[model samples]
Target: MTDSTYQFTRAITRRPAASVVNGLRAEDIGTPDLEQMLKDHAHYVATLKSTGADVIELPPLDGFPDALFVEDTALCLPKGAVLMRPGAPSRMGEVAQMAPTLRSTYSEVREITGPGHIEGGDILVTGREILVGRSARTDAEGVRELTAIVSDWGYRLREVFTPEGVLHFKTDCSLLDGETILSTERLDASGCFEGYRVIHTAPGEEACANTIRFNNLVLMPAGFPKTADILGKAGFEVVEINNGECAKLDGGMSCLSLRF
Candidate 1:
């Protein structure tokens, strides 16, 4: 049986460390408060567990400032998991740190051993196909390598473009379900999501577009009331978590965990 895009039996997450204040960002918004970030992280994991999924809580990696964004380390799928090669030089070590865990969990684990770089944040797996966007951290070569690897597993990978200035392809959109997508107006206008049911984020609430549909709940960043209401009315069970702290480091709900 194929994996449902939003259904999962387990997830992996890491605790935020004090070094998170030094995480890379597109611009300096503010230093993420460690105290608040921890609180939010706990809430995120709790919500996942509440969905009857096993939540693997990894210890903090103080050496990696962006370790809290575990989803970027690898892509978990039903067949196995693929380790990503992050474009950010500072984040390369993170992949090694995550490898052991994945190896122990998956009988087959592949790595993007390449001159090109990619991150899990740039890849979105829907029910029908895998959509990947080339960003500063994810290049054509990286996408090509990933395409080759997943193709052997009988998965179709499609190349797309990330909106200009977006940190990741998923920074502007997310899968609401197998056939539905939640996207920003700018991203939807790019036509990448053509042929899929699209729900545009309420104007000015584009930041909330990076949400995750985990099992029965749609976990989104708190404070985007309009977008939250839209999801609720659309027949989704929505749960809002405080994202102010992670937002400083360009992280969101989907960034915190790897589910499969």
Candidate 2:
């Protein structure tokens, strides 16, 4: 395994048109104008690489169309890549497909399965603490099991739960930098992520909470002017990209791909 400060060597992304969203049944969201979607995805991939992050495009899956493939997951520490067991059943195939891609990039790759389903998006890794959100998507059994697996690496695991109806903790909160955190104002912070400086986004800027910290740069969804300004003031070079099409399917900048 490699010991280096979080350098994102590879990433995996899919075209939004191919994303599978379960709720929007009446409207044909999957069959949108793919030409433009492809164009946008290409631009996104290019921008991600421009940050010096290697980007790997996964071959599209045939059977599962509405897979919450990207956002509903997480990547393991060092070089032992543990593909998450996604909360949504439709996304199960994504982990299987992601395995080879990870093996091609890293030396060791593993899977978190059986009686313990979890998502990478719900797990936030700071200097030494690994904070996981136990919600509809991730369960206590999953967190305990994963913590045990990664304990040898010396990471402390903590669990937080959101009030009912909040899909994922990361959907409303994200660690922006070493000491800074971007979170939705509505989240209950009583015992969650204590001691870190909290930066609150505006009412509708909850989506902006999903920013990704790659190297020294922060990739944020374009259009949240206030959130961008806040991040900029905090000494992060913020790069904004339009994820309108992906956003329609409950996806965001961070949700579109995984960095490792």
Candidate 3:
């Protein structure tokens, strides 16, 4: 009763760890405000549930400062789920911690082992083909391993290099639908999403490109009003959630959880 056109009937999220103030990021943004973050996360969960997904909340991994950004740990494909080998050594343990839960939800659970480093943030599954970002966080070996894992499922893998200054390919692009991709100009110009209608985020609001399209609703980070207006003009309903804390850590809506 949960699965639908969204291809996601459930969402797995872990509470923000108190030690997140010490988490990793490209820049040294000030520490996050925990109280506000809690409120924001609550709203995020409520909004996701409004889309009809069963939200699975996992306990905070106090030992891992960046565990809240669980999306980097694994990826959930229609056929099954794949436990990743995070590029960040500090984040490597998160994949193992998430595997048990993934195994219970997916019919088949696979993993990227050894020298392979695969973060879900560097991966985009379009139901038909898989786009793997060749970024600092994702290597060719990891992409090759994932390709092998999904090759039997009729999913072809496309490799694209992440633009400089972008932490991940998804940091500047996201699929709005099968034929459309919401992205920043810099990313769209990379010719990454050829064949898909590319909708560029409003000027000065490039971060808005990292959105989560659930069913018919678009879960976008708040404070990007201009970008939200653009999406609205594109005929998509936008639900905004304040992610100040996550933003401080270079996280976004898609980074908070794994949906499948």
- The candidate scoring highest on TM-score is 1
Ranking by TM-score: 1, 3, 2
| Model 1 TM-score, 2 decimals | 0.99
Per-residue CA lDDT of model 3 for 99-188, tens digit only, reads 899988988998998587889898876644788898888999998899998886767889899998789888898877776778899988
Error of 1 at 226 (Å): 0.5
- Which lDDT values do the candidates have, in the order given? 0.93, 0.69, 0.85
TM-score to true structure, per model: 0.99, 0.86, 0.96
Question: For residues 92-133, could you state the per-residue lDDT of candidate 2 as single tens digits?
Answer: 777776677677776877668768788876877765577788
Which residue runs of candidate 1 sit more than 4 Å off their true CA positions? 1-3
User: For model 2, what is the alpha-carbon lDDT of residue 189?
Assistant: 55
Error of 2 at 179 (Å): 2.3
For residue 130, model 2's alpha carbon misses the true position, in angstroms, by 1.2
The reply for model 2, stretches above 4 Å from the true place, is: 1-6, 17-33, 66-68, 71-74
